[model samples]
Target: MAADVDWDPYYGDRRTVLALVGLNLDAAAITARLTGCLLTDDELADGFAAWPGWADPFAGFFPLTDDINPA
Candidate 1:
């Protein structure tokens, strides 16, 4: 599921969102750094909780040219 995400000032793009559903601390940490966030375990959990209904936890960035199908 990939729909328009809230615009992030740091990333400066609505499509610059990524989620790691199940990863170890090391991998998640690396990914967070790559994604420009130094998220704590709680923060990551919050992200999952706050995720939009139209988005999937495993979905990567979706370009504007693509269609978003949450189903």
Candidate 2:
């Protein structure tokens, strides 16, 4: 995702805010590195509460099992 942003300058503007769900993502670190900032925990929950689609931003790309995979 960071590479995509670096390759395409407009990518940042296209996806201004990123909402990570069902994953232990470091939003602050990501925010500092990429131009597209991630949404906070409260904001993510609010989005899920407001919209059903917001609950799964990855469109079911996440793993089915509860296995830890280091990135």
Best by TM-score: 2
Off by over 4 Å in 1: 1-14, 32-71
Q: lDDT per model, in order?
A: 0.54, 0.57
Per-residue C-alpha lDDT of model 2 across residues 1-71, encoded as one tens digit per residue: 57565465643544345566756687775557554335666766686556553545454545677668656
On lDDT, the leading prediction is 2
Model 2 misplacement above 4 A: 1-15, 36-71
Candidate 1 TM-score, C-alpha based: 0.20
lDDT of 1 at 54: 34
Mind giving the per-residue lDDT tens digits that candidate 1 earns over 29-65? 5575565544466766677556454335334543455
- Residue 56 of model 1 has an lDDT of 51
